[model samples]
Target: MLVELLLAAIVLVLLALVLWLLTTTRRELGELRQATAPADAVTELLRRQIEAVRAEGRDGQEAVRREVSDLALRMRGDIGGLQQSVASELKGVSTEVTHQLHEGMKLIQNAQTTMGDRLDRAAQVVAEVQGSLGKLGEATLRVVEVGKDIQGLEQILKSPKVRGGLGETLLAELLSQMLPQEHYTLQHPFKSGERVDAALRIGDRLVAVDAKFPLENFRRMLDEGEEDKRRPVRRQFVRDVRTRIDEIAKKYILPDEGTFDFALMYVPAENVYYEIIIKDETDLADDPIATYALSKRVVPVSPNSFYAYLQVIILGLRGLKIEANAQNILNDLARLAGDLDKVREPLRTLGRHIGNAQSQFTEAERALDRFGAKLETIERKGGAQAELPEVGS
Candidate 1:
């Protein structure tokens, strides 16, 4: 387009030069024609020169106009092409922006929905916690009443709810659901014999888990405010826990019964377990009273550690699945063998009885053979006797 404009400008300048020359040439020719006498030859030559200049100027002007028109047409085409290219580029950019806006709006909406769901969950959790708090108040009242009732019974020499009796049983039942039924065997004295709270059977060894932690003493620790007044009671409670672990090890874990390869003092209460683990004393070995062993090692496990133990049990159960499968195959083989023996015994006995009966029948078969020979002899005699009877007739 720029080239076309430049060419048009050049053509217009040439045409202006041609028009000026043509006018000057015509004026010169008129002057030359009017002049006469001996200067006529000079006037005639000037007239011919003016005529040639006029003809050449007219041809140049025509050519210049044609070139200007072509250049103008080419410039118009170039401008139209540039306008189309600009329009298409703008349209593409606008379309891309619109697409991005839609995507951004979708992401915003998704984020809003996710935030709303999380808020709803938080509200639900708050409601549930409020309900739980109310229930906990009622449970506290029941426990107080139960403790008073048991104490009243104990005064009368009946011993209502002892620590190792009903409490351990209830706690064991709660523990059983989280654990394998076979791996954890309930050992409350309902079956007689020196039983444990629960026995976790691991291979040939047993982890005798006794649920015996003085919750009452721990509760006193929680209840006590003054450190000076609380210290003596707190010290006694520590001693009580140490004693409890030792007593459980001696009572529940009988090495004679293969009870304690290592025993577990299963505290279902996390706080109680943490208290013992965190609670230090003069007799404590590693961390606190929990890790401190009595006979061999009584590993104290709270709810969390017990869960870890349960996970171990789950993996153990998976391994035991293979043992169970092998056991089932062995049981099936034994049953098959027993059934085959049952069938085979009857068949063997029947064969023996048949042999005995055959012995009894051998004499009878021989006697019958002798009787048949005597009968043949009688037949021959009868023929001989028939001729004598004919003579007598």
Candidate 2:
């Protein structure tokens, strides 16, 4: 477009210049015609010069037209080549853009699918969490109820009578499980009419057991958080344990009543037993409570230790019964041997009589054979006599 515009501008300028030259030449010829002498030569000279200028102008116009036509042809070829090149580049760019759009759409679809799966999983997790929260609420309520029941139990345990009764009941249950009904007596009375909690029969002797022990002081000691405050409570607990031990030892360890020298004091709770014995241990010696109980012949035993003791007693009783059974078996075997000896002579006499009878039967068989031979001889003799008589006849 710019080249075409430049070509048109050049042509217009050349035509204007040619017109101006013609106009100036016509004016000079008119001036020359108006003049007098020698005007003809000047008119001819000016006319020829004007014709030469017109010829030069026509030649210049033809050259300008040829140049403009050639330039227009060259510009057209260049413009066609540029348009094809731009079209090819645009086609390549459009193809690449289409491919990128397809890939982007695929990526978006995949992302949507992944997001949907994640949302579904999140919803399921939320539901599970809600269910867990509901279960946790139920568990919390159950724990509250259990707490109230525990408080009631604590109140009941605070009574000395209730605690003693529970301890005795626990003692009785353990005794019933571990020993035969006849082997243990509950509330066994002494000559002074004082009753021990239970008594185990070991052979002809009894081992007394006491289950009632003071627990209030021990509980108080446990409840006191500060060491200084707990110290006095602990001391009182020790005193209570010692007093119970003394009572058991004096009342239950009665040799005259067929009781063993040592008695058992049953501690219903293992922790209480631990406090009385294991927890009080020092570097110098064993726990004072355990040592004192042992000195007084009152063995303090927790439920576990008491069960183990009962197991041992059961094993000992089994051993005794086996020994008695073995003695009875030996006695029975001896009596059987003596009875067999007494029958020995009669068995010998019967064997002799059987031997004599066998010998007599053999002699009788021989005698019968001899009698058959004699009868045969008589028959032969009779036949010979008969044959001679027939000859005489």
Q: How does each model score on lDDT? A: 0.73, 0.90
Residue 330 lDDT, candidate 2, scale 0-100: 99
Q: Give the top-scoring candidate (TM-score).
A: 2
Q: Residue 290 deviation, candidate 2, in Å?
A: 1.9
RMSD of each: 14.1, 12.9
Which regions of candidate 1 deviate over 4 angstroms? 1-166, 188-193, 279-287, 323-393
Q: Candidate 2, 198: how far from true, in Å? A: 0.5
User: What would the per-residue lDDT of candidate 2 be over residues 1-393, giving only the tens digit for each residue?
Assistant: 777788789889988988998898788777766775566777678778988988998998899889888988898898889989999999999999999999999999999999999999999999999999999999999999999999999999999999999999999998888899989999999999999989999889999999898999988988999988988888888888888999998899999989989999999999998887998833333359888899999999999999999999999899989999999999999999999999998999999998998899899889999999999999999999888755566
- lDDT for 236 in candidate 1 is 74
Would you estimate the TM-scores of all the predictions? 0.40, 0.60
